[model samples]
Target: MNAKIIIVLVSVVAAAGAIATFYSQAHAPLERVTEGFETGYGGWAPDADVPIDPNTGQPVDWYVARSTDVSFSGTHSLKFFIDGRQDDGTIWIERKVLLREGARRVNITFDLYSGEESFNTIAVVCAYAGFKDPEHEGELTVLGPANEVAGWKRYSLAVDIDTGNAQEAWVAAGISVRWETHMTYYLDDIIIEVT
Candidate 1:
């Protein structure tokens, strides 16, 4: 092999590698975060009405508190306390943000922890709802009904955002349980990326 040919071949390979790296980084998804749950609720607002717990005979709104006992990625995590009323209630934490126009997609990911080995009760459940635009009536990707217990687990959902006719989007997470169910769920490290 000629010395010059070897040099040219090496140069070509290096150039190709550089180009590939640039392309990958350039096309990486951008953050359109609704919440990370790394700090408090990260702007998530409660959207459920407080109901009287039939068992305790006390009014309990959907409760969210910072938990230090367990976390998916940090020292703290959000704990969602589902009431024991058993009225098919869902406690939601939601954030409203404006979606960028044009064809777009959103990816939602989060970590969860369940205390029990399995959801034995009729009210046991795990559920997540991704972003939705009311104006466009866009479909959302929901991930849930998971009965994972004892350890930290990650969940994700990817859905298209019809931004052509939609400007605002709602990002939410919730726990839905049957009447007479009582449980505490953990959530953390939530992320929303757009592309």
Candidate 2:
């Protein structure tokens, strides 16, 4: 009887340990990456889509580069420029992140610095996270207005994807032109987490 009780207690303890391990593994993040643009683009690259210029028959002017004009945290930030004369265009910086082989969710958070706030929306903030890289503006999800605040503002996006056997996922954030005019914006302090 004593031996049987001891074996039962051992089994219960082992089960409890296994349960704890599973809980922690399920709740913990699989991967995380943060970028401030202090050193460089941090594996991020810029992409854009704009209307073709009538004369050049090519996409209108759009630019993205590291700059010191304004930053949310560090001394540098990513600058995005777009010609909104036609009132249509999208600009964003994108990067790939590693993911565990399974169904997982990605959470992205970042800061945007606007020169000023206005009721008239010049552009809207957008983000994307999925199994494939976003090739067109339509693939991005609009989060909110970019000009909501005069200075730095925080934005977040979460996406659940079936990674399956894939080991990489793409994440991006930027702005979509709204009003007809030229516009500039800054992005900084980006954080990506996979769970």
Candidate 3:
């Protein structure tokens, strides 16, 4: 191609790149956020169907609890739970900020706490389409273990959604905690970021 033609092509490519970057950033900027949850309650207690912390006003960091009335009473902080082997209970917290469509990628992270003496690995599970998908079938997921000495530890998962080359794509995202039925768990400061 001629010099003039090459220059035009380069300019077009640069402009296109800038637009794409801006679009992506606009959608999924980075930060820690509660995203969504019910406000009013104040705190979380064990075996409470209303698993999320009312004080924090953040949804339970796990499956939607069986009932909203179910409430947590102690532990002095946020908590998450699961039905034992029978496995039932969820806390369906609606979404606040949808992951930006152009999200370059995301890291879902949270600090989990356990009041038990020794516990199984608690999952800071991320569900692409959390409540909408039952059994988490057809959902992309990232889980962190919380079996360690339970206090507060930063756990995170980095993900890139494979939209199969579709024009519009995103990984549906939400967090969940699973454990032997009747287990107690806690969560705080979950976040998603585009870096």
The best candidate in terms of TM-score: 2
lDDT order of candidates, top first: 2, 1, 3
Question: Candidate 2 — which residues are off by over 4 angstroms?
Answer: 1-25
lDDT of 2 by residue, 1-195 (tens): 699999999999999999999999888889989999999999999998788877688888999999999888869999999988888999999999998866479999999988999999999999999878898999999999999999999999999888878989999999999998999999999999998
- Model 1, runs deviating above 4 Å: 1-22, 34-38, 49-60, 119-142
Residue range 1-195, candidate 1, lDDT tens digits: 999999999999999999999998667764467454556677777555346666678766568777787887758888878665556555656676556545377666777777765655433333333344222112222355534557766877767766767666666655666546667777788777766
Backbone clash count for every predicted candidate, in the order shown: 3, 0, 26
- Candidate 2 residue pairs in clash (backbone atoms < 3 Å): none
lDDT value for model 1 = 0.63
Model 3 residue runs over 4 Å out of place are 1-78, 87-96, 99-102, 117-142, 162-181
Q: What's the lDDT of the predicted structure labeled candidate 3?
A: 0.44
As for TM-score, the candidate ahead, 2 or 3, is 2
Distance from true location, Cα of 67 in model 2, Å: 0.7
Better of 1 and 2 by lDDT: 2
- Write candidate 3's Cα lDDT for 1-195 as tens digits: 799999999999999999999998666554334422245322212222324445466533343232232223222324444533333233322232344334455556555555543555544444342223233322545454455564555566665653333333232333344553456555554454543
TM-score of 3: 0.46
